[model samples]
Target chain A: MDVRSRNHVTVTGRVGGPVVMLAHGFGCDQNMWRLVVPALERDFTVVLFDHVGSGNSELSAWSPERYSSMDGYAEDVLELCRELALGPVTFVGHSVSAMMGVLAAAREPEAFAGLVLLAPSACFIDDPDTGYRGGFSAADIDELLESLDANYLGWSGAMAPVIMGNPERPELGEELTNSFCRTDPGIARVFARVTFLSDNRRDLSQVRVPTLVAQCSSDAIAPPEVGEFIHAQIPGSRLTTLNATGHCPQLAAPEETAAAIAAFARAAG
Target chain B: MTCGTGGEEGGRERDNGSGPGEEEALFSALLEDSTEDLYEHAPCGFLSTLLDGRIAKANATLLDWLGYRRSDLVGRRHFSDLLTVGGRLYYETHFGPLLRMQGEVSGVALELKAADGSRLPVMVTSKVKTGIDGQPLLIRTTVFEARDRRAYETELLRARREADQERDRLKLLNATLQTTLLPPALANVPGLDVSAYYHIASADEVGGDFYDLFPLATGTWGLFLGDVCGKGATAAAVTSLARYTLRAAAVYDPDPAAVLANLNTVLNHEYNGDDPRFCTVVFGLLTPDADRGGFHIVLASGGHPPALMMRADGTADFLPTPGGQLIGVLPDAHIATATVHLAPGDTLLLYTDGLTEARTAAGGEDRYGDDALLAFIRDLAPSTASDTIGAVRVLLGTFGTGVDDDTAVLAVHVPRAGSEERH
Candidate 1:
């Protein structure tokens, strides 16, 4: 299997420099890290890719069985490192992908140098028994799935012309185009279930590499307390709160986010 | 795009004592209502939320539909708070990022929760209102009621699922029907090794290819292979009629030519309408020849492909029954006959034209012609009936998607004097 083609892996930056692989989460694709790629590539090698069934990756490689759990994506991360033959590279995972990094690094600790968990959460649903305030409740995740179903027709590329029917307003044709974040509704629903319903709180301690947990100042999805929870769980992991506010610090504060990653990568090396 | 700024600049003028122009009077009355009325009582709902989704302002149209007072939402609840839990998550994961990246999103169907706990389906279109320095200021939204469209979409999804299940059932029915048109297993003739195969070209439609072997009289067997013109239900009907007629005709007289002529007479009489149906068939009568220790065979053709004979002496060729016109077209059809002795270690194979007419190359005008099949069989001589059919099956499998029509093959082989084997 050509894992690179399956995951839409792209290698850019200094050829022999230390590699930093960036992984995007559920809704979008490789374009999530486009803002910070330029700054990271100047000094360190940057590897970017879309998860299977997202963005420019080959959609045919997406199977419900293979990608049902976090292990499927974790397995892809390890295969990519082996195929690229980048020795002990740094991995930066956003949102749900942060758990993927933890799962991957735990299985093959030798394949990674360090991990940067940006706006990550060990779990997204609230746990009453454990008294953990990860975030939303289980019923909320079900609601999210229903919302995806309701908008299924709107997500299809064939429906774009129908929805953007206003010719007088050019913005309807330009900005609202379903290009980068448009996922197949069926795939998006599965990913939504996987993202919100999964609990990896116990797996946080399994990450053996030096890790940096970066969270935004204010994110509705992953709040400050959730970030604190992730930081306390990972042993000897450093936690930093960026000045930006949103679930995506890479897009919100690209410069500071890139600087933090570069300093951490150099220290880990 | 501030709310209600469209066409609200009409000047209020006092009516003169004398009759003024009728058009001017009507135009003045329409615009005199003021922008506040247009914003508050418009048919569609409108809102302006801050960048962080806190609602700064909302029109009366939306607040009225949600059964909320103006103070309940303005400067208090976020735009997402108006959505159901699922819609809120959809907003965070998909809709928010899309708006931030693309600057606008339109016609996103979502359900809003009212204070009364009723779900109001609505279509939302939001745009980012940029400041003078190209900095994001706030989001302007327009919401339209979409109850009818939502109901239609739900019905569409249900109909689509039923259509999918209906197609699957049709395929199963077609497969079962196809089975009934052919014998489950060939008749186990004594002192003969026999093998047969049918390759269906489609799963959704029953094919017309059929073959059977049955006992005709004492110490004799009657067998036939044929293909009806066209396909599906109409051709399947003709195939069923042809198969039964051949069996009945052979029982009256065991002569191969006489059996085929009788079939032609019956088909011509039954289907002599404006749209006549026809088929190509070959009938053969097999009888044990005690003097030669083999079976004596007399075969008749009705515009069907010639049968292939692999002799025991390591040579193979087609038994050409030329001038065999198609059956059921004329009052008296011309049937062609040929005789061959099926000695020990010799094999005779019957087949339809699907094998010779199959395409051999992808997107190329190359077909698996008769010459290719002949060359293949020439090298396959001195083999038993089972081995011959097995090799032919392997050859057909190699063609892959190139074989586009239904095909059937039946082989009869006589084992060596000491073997007494079944193929």
Candidate 2:
């Protein structure tokens, strides 16, 4: 199997530079890193890819047995890294992908130089017994699933709007609107369950490499304490809060996000 | 009141300098009321929110529909507050990011939570209202009620699930029906080795291939393998009739040629119509040769592929049963017979054309033909009947999806004095 075609892997940035691979979370594809890729291109060899069954990745490759849990996604990440063969790369994972990176690095620590986890939560559902708050209730996650059903027919209509008048990059408007975050609903359901319900808190201590836990200052999804919790769990990990709002710091504050990734890759390499 | 009438008659028509008639005066009053009335009583609800999603204004229609007062919503509620918990998460993760990037979004369906805790299904369209400096200021949203549309979608989803269930049930039914057309197990013929295998090409559609082995009257056995024309329900019906008729006919006559002739007569009479069904079959009658220490077998064919023999001396060839006509194709179909002595360490195999016609990886144009099967068995000569059947099964597996039709094979071998037990 051609792993590149299966995952829709794309490689860009300075050739022969230290590798930095970016993995998108749920809902969106590789385009989630469009804002951050430019700043990192000067210093690192960047890699971007969509998870299977999302964006332009091969839908036929996705099976419920393999992708129902976190292991399936983590396997794809390791396979992608193996396929690239760009020795000892730094992985920059966002949202749910942070957990995937954790799983991948834990399984094969030698494959990675360092890890940058952005706006991540090890588990999304709150556990009352342990007093660990993962930001959402189990019932709240179900509601989110219901919301996905509501938009089943409305997805195309939502994508139909023309993205006009973004002053930063007018030429990119055509490509941006249709391609961003358009996921197959069936795959999206499995991914949503995997992203929100999976508990990777126990997997954190297994990391044997340098790790950076980057948090957004005002993210509704992963609050500041979640970042602190992750940092405390990992051995000798550093936590830094970005001056950005929302769950997506890469898009909200790209320059700062990219700079953090580049600085880490250089120092870790 | 003819308001367009001649000049001085305007007073009776109640025309003034400002207006022509009472209807015109009423229209003028309505025109003056429209500005505020249009905003408050529009068919769809409207809301204007700050860039941060705080509601700056809520139309009276929106407030009334949601069972909320103007003071209760405006300046206090965010646009997401009107949504259900699920809708709010969806709005934040997908809809909010889209609206922020796209500048405008439309026809997004979401369920709103009313003050009374009931659900209100709605479709919303929102556009960013940018200031003159080209920075986003606030959002202008229009909400359309979609109660009927949601009900319709729910019904559609339910219907799709039923169809999927029905399809799965049909496949299970097909498989059960297929098993009934063949013998549960081959009858154990003492002092002789017998083996059979049937490969079903599809689970959904029942294939038209069958084989059976059973005991006849006294110290004799009957066996046959055949392929009925076409596939699915109609072909399956024909296969069931052919298998039962061959068994009953063999019990009556025990002669290989006579048994097949009886089957042809039964089928030709039963299906004489335009959609007449037919099959190619090979039937065999085996009797133990007391002195020669092997069985004497007579094989008959009805437009079927000839049987093959793998000999004790490491050689293989097909037994020619020429001039046989397809059963049920004519009033009097000719049955051709070939006699062979099943010597020790010699195996005779009967099969349908599905075996030879199987496509091979050599390309679409190539088939694993009669010559290839002859050569393959020649390589495995001096083999037992059970071993030959096992080898054929492995060969068929190599074809994978190339074998589109069902295949049936039955092999009979006479073991040498000290040969290994039949597999």
Candidate 3:
């Protein structure tokens, strides 16, 4: 009970129907959901806040030992939900945040109504028998980690193109690249390692909430098979394939992507 | 207790009785002559600590490396105070347990903080020195310099990084060279479905795989996909020559079997010496037939895997082009030629053995075989060439980095009139 209770959170929606909370991926803040927030705010209450050590969030609240794992981020999501009095909320997440959402939802199923996962990759290394094709080889991941340690900006520049391979939606890649570059280099390195190396396929099975996995057709980072893997593992989860390519389908095909999410939420509700 | 009180009083009495205090004289001589020299010049650093890891005694050698006076370390700081953050964790996790279990432990490596907070790599040995009756006492610790070993490891890592860079540069160059060996774009043959995919096994080394569809004499089209035997610049050289020679030869002959024959003859004449170049090629020629609205295709094989024929009615089987010898091996190679009629909606898939020969798993000998490919083709028999190719692309992506060699697939389908436009 001695834990800090003075923590504050902001919630906003004009034409509220239900609540949808979003958590951003590694090296990014809550501002990543800006493009999709406008569309969601039209129909639902949207709750947005940065995790500690990121964006508008208080940096003084960050403790390296506490924030060492995604559990800290999960606690932030749960705390934000509790503070906002948001019950049975739809949680939208990207990359590592998607797994964090899964862990959070698994921990408290009554708090989370559903999950919207975009470019969710459990593990980046390839496992032959399981037919999971997360693009990088073991040595490739090692080189990636080493480069992250040596020069974070250089690593982001190299990774951005690979993650966003779609030539048509160049802006999506630009946004991702910018978001990655904006992160503090030291924190970015640790966050990147945690994101890429984290194995969350096991956590998928524990998610009892209704889940929507909107996957890009030609994403080099999270291929369709990865989405299929998530769909197969998570019970009662629906998989919707997007014609868009690259990791961030929201930036590429926001209208169609948003429509799918809305439909899923409506159906679940 | 007996030695401390009784010996001290007896030593005083003996000093009074003896002429020059013999035992005390010898003890003083050893301390003055040998102890300081031993402490200063010993191979390892000698230090004592309190129960709280505080330094009590430290040798001059350890103090010199740390840029500290002996008085600075002893009685002032704990042993953990000297360690870096990582070293402190190691001390808590591994060092403390082993020291507690055994009376002594040795060869524990750690980074010790110097006087200016700079790091000094060291190997520490510690022992629990006890009283004569095994009662608890102070801890004794020894540390050795790890400067040379740390330097060697750093250099080795640097060298490894350089080697990796060299390999990556070579891979980029090989990718560029491989691009040149194949046509920039295969000439779009009208009324025929065309889709080709190339899978490179290792980017660091170039594999010889060349495929092209070129127009020949008499309104015919000749296409071939071949793999040269070896790798690197040598294989790349042969690949370039073979690709150009096949195109050039097809322009002269226009017959699929004869085009391959001429290519074989040219390769035999050019690279038929010691350390000669050899490759397996499957050549196909498409020509309009008067009897049927479809095209008559003659496929000549030179020691290549059979081309799969996925029919319009959803049945799939391999084209019979057997008994072909590997090109460039002999002066007169036996070429196997088979003629097939490509009606509307029929597709022909030509590929290298790399598709079938890829290992499915680590420590697994199960190659993704001909039967699996047949089933895969069977699933897509009634599809357009482009859809077939797109599906195959997805399948290849699924194979991921497991396909340890290059794979090239060139498919030509005589599509239904409207179907060709969509494809």
Candidate 4:
């Protein structure tokens, strides 16, 4: 059934079949699952939608204060599920959304059957006392922010290579640069602060679902240690490492990522 | 000739009468020559140091800047004696070595301690004097007030730090904001495998490639992927507006072409002035056709690159939906639509131009174009949606730094019957 979401949440797939939900990471949207959906549609129902401020979603639904925290996003997820009667869903999230899914599943564990997280980051800022690796220091973050404000396009252009760092066939930097240049500076500014500065390590313990954490071995943004931390914190969570160096493994190693998901889904079933 | 002779005679007579005047002129010349000497005593103190790093001569200008008297430095104390501890160390370690090697060192920044214990910033230049035998005799040093330079340097450093902090805040804000522009994840539709990948060429900021596949009506899905022109705040604003408008408009009417038309109208109207915004997009409606046991996809394009059709037989080609115009350019846009039957084992790929146009190398000469993409898929025939996207994802990874543009790829595949539902 069609339902209205404050965030323009649209429902798809079989209404009565088991619901499978997907979420993208920082700098991406729900479309990351396009390659995985067709194969999934064979047995279960699927539900896909952008976050409130995400792709093809309601821009007005974005409030800096509201989106600053993932609680509102979790609420939107729960509300969308309720509206579509897509209960007992298998929540699959990428990057920051992994923590977001944790937040949602924690609030309504009964609403979800399992969670598959791809390249998840619980905390992106370092905590020396806790031994957490966030890649850059607070000073570095300050420098990065200044760079962004000074010239958003320039900063994005410079960062493309770092974001798409792959040892072999390293040409995705241009793609990242173009992407950075295509976005509005204001939106990019806000999104940069939210993705890098916001830390949500404490939220991992709250997850109680059958969680599968897929991590990239050489991700500069969210290193391997982070995946281990998430797996350690989230009780009964399984961790698998993909031999990729990029921040977005699904885009870099889709076959391995899909295989992992397929294997995990089967194991869960 | 008579007038010249008379003038010469008159000049000679004048000259004869001007001996006293000549003497007075000489006296005046002497007085005028002493002006530099007078400068030494004219309120400001001055001083010069010898080549051996000792005070050889000093004037009032030098004494004033250092808050010292001539008796305290000239022929009495070494020039380094008036320096602060740090300044003396710096002079000995760095300044002395450089000056000795260079023969002359100008504007050597240093700090001096005053008699009253206050610090004085000064720029000093010193040159070595040599005798006729080419033997070094002494050093002559000049000092300039450096309070302003010090202040300026301090201000510059402060500004740099502030700018860095501001950039960091923006980066985080940009990251989060960028996240909001796309879905956290696209759900796996039952009976079909799906995979999508968005390649952002940058991370210090945001990009304008947007895509989504969300539930619309009963047993149907709505999905779209598009690229907005330009970057920074303006492009981001348009991106947000377009993303939301498309989703909202789709909810209003789930028709792929109509949804794009609605988006086109909103963007054109909202950003219709000078410095207007526009974008290339492809919108699709996926409904499970029980007759096909897959999906009936109505794909629409708005000046966007065509979606690739990777058939179950392993043939991949651009789904020809040409003649579409860019959204937000005109009041009314022609959105091209195409209907396709997604059979089991069929995979459809939608992507932004960033993928096709991305440079295959640092020089950006070799592009991963339509033919190359088709050839690539030809090798991976009979691929599932996830598999196809996974392969493309690897391709994106392989492109590495060459793919300078942000690419958004949305792939939908119809899984074959009797395939393992799980795992």
Which model scores highest in DockQ?
2
Q: What TM-score describes the B chain of model 4?
A: 0.72
Model 1 spans with C-alpha error above 4 angstroms: A157-186, A243-246, A250-269, B1-20, B33-37, B69-71, B131-137, B175-203, B210-226, B233-276, B281-301, B305-322, B325-423
> Residue-wise lDDT of candidate 3 within A82-109, one digit each (tens)?
7666567888887678888998999988
Model 2 C-alpha lDDT per residue in residues A1-269, reported as the tens digit of each score: 79999999999999999999999877777877887899888888999998998878888999999999999999999999899999998999998999899999999999999999999999988889998998889898898887787777667656665546655765566566556545778778888898889999999999988999999877778878899999999998999999876677786677899888888999997
Query: How close is every model to the real structure, measured as TM-score?
Result: 0.76, 0.76, 0.54, 0.49
Q: Provide the lowest-lDDT 10-residue window in model 4 chain A.
A: A156-165
Model 4: CA > 4 A from native: A1-269, B1-60, B69-109, B124-142, B199-206, B272-276, B289-294, B311-314, B343-346, B359-405, B413-423
**What DockQ do you compute for every candidate structure?**
0.31, 0.44, 0.02, 0.01
Candidate 4 C-alpha lDDT tens digits along A22-80: 77665445555655666666655767777656545556666777676667667777887
Q: For candidate 1, lDDT tens digit of each residue in B1-423?
A: 221222443222222232356545656777898899999889999999987788898999999999999899989888888998778778876777667665777778899999999999999999889898977799999999999999998787778668879999999998999999999989988889999889988887889999999998789999999999888999899899999989988888878888888888888888989988888999999998899977999999999999999999999999999988788888788899999899988999999988998888645678999999999999999888888889988888888777788999999988888784753
lDDT of 2 at B334: 94
Q: Which pairs of residues collide in candidate 1?
A: A143-B86
Model 2 Cα displacement at B62 (Å)? 3.7
**Candidate 2 ranges beyond 4 A from true positions:** A1-6, A56-63, A153-187, B1-42, B46-61, B68-78, B92-107, B125-142, B180-202, B213-223, B268-277, B285-298, B305-323, B329-331, B338-423
Specify the CAPRI tier of model 1. acceptable
Error of 2 at A266 (Å): 2.8
Q: What is the overall TM-score of model 4 with all chains considered together?
A: 0.49
Q: Each candidate's lDDT (Cα)?
A: 0.86, 0.86, 0.73, 0.72
